[model samples]
Target: MGKLQQFLTGLAACFGAILMGSLNVWPSYTLELYTDNTTTLLTAPMSEFESSLVGSLPSLGAMLGTGITGVIIDFFGRKRGAMLLILPIILCWIIIEFSSSSIPILIARFMGGVGGGANLVYAPIYISEMAEPSIRGSLASGTVSLYCLGALLSYLSGWFLSYGMIIWVNLSLCIAALVLLSIVVESPMFLLRQKNEQEALKALAHYRTGSTGSKSVLEELSLMKQQLLPPVELVSVNADAEANEEATEKEKLNTDEVVVVVPPKSSSLKLLLCACGGCVRTGANRRAAFTSNASCRAFLVVGTALTLQVMMGMIAVQVYAGTLFKQAAPDLSAHFCSALFALVLLAGGTVTGIVADKAGRRVLVISSSALVALCMGALGFLMQSGVAPAWVSAVVILVYCFCFNFGAGSVPYVLLAEVFTSEVQGIASMILVEWVWLLNFVLIAVFPFMKSLMGVHGAFYVFACVAVANTILSYINIPETKGLSNKQIQEVLHPKVDKQNSIDASLSVCQKAVFQEP
Candidate 1:
């Protein structure tokens, strides 16, 4: 068995995500600095719009960063693209340290958001590519778990440290992460797709070699190469020409002659793109690598599942957990409840890291989402009824925190990395990840108003409804990806052909067939 060397560098790169998660709740932590005259850091306390903008701008910056991530990562390479962000992150801290008013802080947070947004895109994508399928989901889920660790640390600092102190501490962590990131090797898969086979093999061997000998590393590399080039069925190929090519080519051939075409024999970057199904769609011929119908279904499953997870109010919980706790139990300290909420988030994420690969993705998502809905519904009823004990709200909310973080909360991030083929993974991740930021901004912007109008109970009721919808959607649409290779995932998504669940069969296309050279 290979030790998890890939996980260390990937996790180091992901340390920047802690910056994103911490900055998200930055406004909430610093709200009192403006509201309290004694601690006032500003000349004049901000108006609601300014306060909200402080929170919203980071999200907007995140959206901007995510929109361009595909271009930057693909063009500059992942490690280089990530290194370029250190300057902005360092700059964001400098601006915040000198901030005497809302404007400087606003600019700082937005710049920080750019780094935060890119963190989500690169961390998960990098890890998924680094690990083998048997351990891939678990390692990728660690990103989300470590994000919770960042949140917990932020909450701790908020309780005892000043806002300036918090900014300086985060800056130090980013610096340390940069030093660690310097040692990271470029992704082998990325090297392979760029047609740098020798470098790709070297990187792959570095990650894959441990107690295992050189032979196992070579086998893993070959397997990865095979997955990079999937086979297209005869029926799928002929579907593009609508029988026109079949008849025209038939005239030049006899019935005994079989026109066999496979993907290119050379390890060209173009062939890698064709294998991904994304760039394949760019041709005049409409048949994608996995075929069009399968592509559509996979898209819908990922898009709808991730969108629903946000609609269920996970962002609101993360952003406003302290405020919501104040409403739920007036006797308890808001900061204490916030600490507990984050603690549960960390614990739940730890559990996900352990269980994700063992249990299927579909069951975890459906079951956890449903459980969250029930807990939220019960909490709303308890609050509305005016009879529950203060301790009950804490108990109810802690359970909700755990459930939400486990699957409904983290699976979307995992699936976003998993669902798309390599050809479109960059662009697809940009869109989906940005969508997360967009939803976070909208939900946080409206949350105070929603709470004022309906009270906390009413808002919880709305969240519970969305959670219910998420559970049903997961049951109906999401496929289990535990222990399955990308080829297996493609097979599950594309069921139009009489395909079997053989990883070797799907990967053996090039070895089995011949391409008609142009």
Candidate 2:
């Protein structure tokens, strides 16, 4: 896309990231109200389980939301899919504004989670669809970088604002995101899939060149069609008409002949079961298999990269920052420490966005993970040995924030979109996003118990080990995809195709496998 249009698209995506930040750190500030001896809710402070649920239920809601977002976007279009998220967020804030009891607060947080989940799934997909190859990685990562900024805002507001005032500010943000997203053009990919090629061309021109009447619009449209379309079976005319079909008859297309696989409106659990079942199902797995070893490796690289992103414990830190800081330094204020952590994270994400297309994905992920591991190990040692001062945990957390954001935080979001071809992108993203949420829930839910078992120090020691393993895996597997076209990346992944041959061979393999009846 042209610079101005690209900027607008990135801006819209970044707005969603900001909303995600609010959802992310929602608990960090709000939970304090219930847990503090200064306050009373439902007659008493939240018990451990209630506290855990209050913080973790949003993840449960997010997991559910992301599971169905793909089908919603597929059927309703990305713009509408994003707009649908706004109501829940607004409702969430409204409920929070009026809530006097714990139950209403819990429900409000769940609603916020629902909105956050959609933002996470849709932002990368929207940015990837709208961006050109030269700037794709940079733009896709920008959403997450903005997410860090949003988190910073969340922490700052949580620290300073009363609950009612914070809800109003968040409500305003939700409305703002809704207005911005409503005006953006529909995704060109969705238009083409619906067989509205003329409109798709207009969108491409508007999105890419900032004009629907540009002279080169058709050329760009043709390139898009070439990359996405393949020869396919069409409805047959009567044999008598068929004789004329090859010679003089106009081509009759049947848009209805296309398969529409809108998955049932199910929660994340059903989706996970369905994904696993599809893995062993005969035709489905074969069709979606990689085109060649390189492609297979590329797929593995990205899938593992996202998983490693979760396991790195960065997100867990976001969710449980208050708890960790409280344990690490009793003398320091948890609220202030968490805010500082988020600020460092925001800086890291900014640096990652500037450097993503230049420094490349592999080196950053490895380097970031390595530094995180070292810091985690050091923090664990200090806490365990009792030789550490109270300030040590704060310093280590700041360092970890920088390390995590520099690579593990932002790059995975970019690659999540960049990894798959257009054909398999939707399913791949749905599954991967679900995986991320599931892993996030497990880590956060078990974290306090882990602390009980091993103390906070031992808990971080385990995280340090996971970080070390992730560093090794990223170093060995990730391919650099800085500035290459999707088509070129496809070729790199599925090298079995003749270098001269286009997407046909790869599409043929995936189409049959991707579309088989379940």
Candidate 3:
């Protein structure tokens, strides 16, 4: 494929990723409006049994669905896993649109949550695998950018259309997802792991050449196949060792095959510790040398960045913006406030994508976090003092939004994924994402209560503190990750002691297995 075609393909993959991630945000955007209206119309307090039941049921269902779908993602290919999710999401929207009672709407929302959970897992995997390594950060971060776009669009739709129209709009999104899937190929990594050489070749060819067939493509396919092939000698050695161990154990038994076996007793704590210490002395001592290194520091920074970004971007801004505006201008419409917030968020994400590669990840992270902190502090002061105008509040919030996306919003995943080796990349990514979701859940659930108790000014003071802490952490710990390959990042993160021990341990194991094999 030509450079243009490859870029377009990458763009499509990014767009798809964004669309999939958007499913996760729809519930958040609409829940407040839906719950408040339902409470008033039912002639009950928001926390009354019936009102709370109707309002909270969907989120409960979504949480349950998210748990189950997270496990299912490992078995199904990312694309197929995501595709499976669309059905339930579409069904949920349909039910929400047509149902009269709270029960049906709750059920639909729960079902949609299942799909959203699956989408969260699959979208990043698909985009990262399909994109060229040179632009992988941009492509991966595009998922976030697009996700914000989806959330913005959802808010816009809700602001302009009736509740019924919003359901139809969500359904249309699911249908559009299905159509897009038909054109996109499965992840090459998934294909390789499945041992589908021909399919993997086809994917690599399409990814590299864009055209179906050519001499150059064939050569590249051959090289990919060779590169992906397993080591037959290693397999042979493992099998031989297993067979020899079985024979040796059999030989130790009586010829009559009447050997009595005594059950091994469990060791006491003292004995277990002694045995463990002995094992450590016999070369397992290397693990102690693996204490917090550059990589570990990077992980910490990345995780913090992720936590703060989601907190500031969606939870803080979406939940509190209208209230803050209302404090300044009592007549400001919720719809108008929400739309403006969404536009600022979209702008932040869009600008981040354009300059991230050039400005570098670490610099953007520190600078952006600092800027957000400053804006947040200003907003808080404005809210505390009665002298600030509504427009000042909005302008400060926009600055906060822009600075956030440019730094914290964009760099977390890129840093986490790039800092680890391929062997541990999946685990690292999972840890970062798990934290993201956990923090998001906490921020969303407690935000209203926090705002009520602290007021808008105090709430923003908390956010500013978080932003400042995040900035300091990034500056001290996270290294520049731009223009560096994954291996290089890993090397920078792992200290000499850890690196040497790892090498020695791996070599020792390989040598023992090789020399002792039958």
lDDT of 2 at 474: 81
Per-model TM-score on C-alpha atoms: 0.84, 0.80, 0.76
- Model 3 lDDT on a 0 to 1 scale: 0.60
Better of 1 and 3 by TM-score: 1
User: Considering lDDT, which of the candidate structures 1 and 3 is the better prediction for this target?
Assistant: 1
User: How far out, in Å, is residue 455 in model 3?
Assistant: 4.5
Indicate whether candidate 1 or candidate 2 has the larger TM-score: 1
- lDDT value, candidate 1, whole model: 0.72
TM-score of structure candidate 1: 0.84
Error of 2 at 18 (Å): 1.8
* Candidate 3 per-residue lDDT over residues 1-518, each given as its tens digit: 53344455444444533443444455545556545755432233233354444434444544554455434545676566656766777787777677656667667766766565444444555655555556666755665677677777776776677766776777777777777665677766668768886787677676775543777656655644543342221111222324465564343332332222221222222222322244323454332222224435555666667776776644667556666667655676766666666677778777767776678888888898889889888988987895767778877876787778767877775665456433233445555565666676678778878879998788888888888888887888777767665546656765455555555543444334444533
Q: List the residue pairs that clash in candidate 3.
A: 1-209, 1-210, 295-493
> Where is the poorest 10-residue window by lDDT in model 3?
230-239
lDDT of 2 by residue, 323-348 (tens): 65777777777667776777888788
- Any runs in candidate 2 off by more than 4 Å, and if so which? 35-49, 210-216, 231-299, 315-333, 452-455, 495-518
For candidate 2, the lDDT comes to: 0.71
Better of 2 and 3 by TM-score: 2
